[model samples]
Target: MLNRSGNTKYQIKDAQQVYRQLSVSYEKIDSTSKKLVAFADKCPNIDENDISSKARYATLCRNIRMYAVQVLQNFSLSTRRVPTEDEIKQARDAKQRSDNELMEKVILSIPGINGKTLELSEELKPFIQQYYQVLQYMQQAKLAGRDDEVKLLESNLEELAQAMRVAHQN
Candidate 1:
């Protein structure tokens, strides 16, 4: 948890851990729901249709509340100081590597849909241009310390590529 109030700052690892916890909770909810449905079906006197939707809703609500509580507890434990300048530098490098991997997959794979040839023609040039725009926005985000904005721009760019492919095909 990165707190705007007080002096708390979260490292990237902390954010990743929170996200992982959320993922695990979602999986747990899915498994529990499946089990409940199976159990309801096994009851001889009860039709699946006779099973109360309210029970399902209540269980989902309880699971969500538990997830929220866990997240809050994690945040309460996340009162560490801001990362040192060196740690920040390392984080930036790691982020750059991750971005490079994603860009290679998402941007470079967009046609004139070549995976790695990197040749540009009239058709492919527009894709490259859009990618450059995304890169520029990402650079600005880095300077402004707005990494999430950069990721949003990347997602938008990826969507634009998909739209372009559809338009070109049509």
Candidate 2:
């Protein structure tokens, strides 16, 4: 009887640990998803003729969205509680709405800059600012055990660095 009780206690502790991990993962996924959506929304506007630049911007947004979806799926599967189809659809719809609203706000704020050509330094300014912001957020995400966010920020930093290098080269 004593051995059985001991086994029961151990099982309970293990279950608690699993629950805790799931909770933490869910919270991280939620927070990082919001950040990804916001970043996508705030992407800088580029000239209409700059097809390559627009492609790069679109790729970045796509990558961010993919990351968010991947994180959500991975966490849900790991917790052994896959979300329903309706839940997944709802999350995607919410993301779409948020992206639309944010993009509208960004477009309205930068009305005159659409077709204008910016100097190298003017163009690099936003990347530099974003680099610093990502660095700060990366630190906080690390402390919070938000590995998905950290990975995303690290990738953003790498892209910013490459962009700056190219800008300097030209």
TM-score top scorer: 2
lDDT of 2 by residue, 1-170 (tens): 13755653334346667777878877777777667666654556677777788677767866877787787777677766445567768999999787556434432333233313434356655655566677789999999999999999888877776766666457
Candidate 2 residue 134 Cα shift, in angstroms, is: 66
TM per candidate:
0.29, 0.31
| Per-residue lDDT of candidate 1, residues 1-170 (tens digit) | 44777677876677667677766775666666556555543555544565586466556656656665676567647745446568889999999787566655655546455556443346755665677677788789989999889889878877877766655465
**Model 1: residue 65 alpha-carbon error in angstroms:** 92
What global local distance difference test value does model 2 have? 0.66
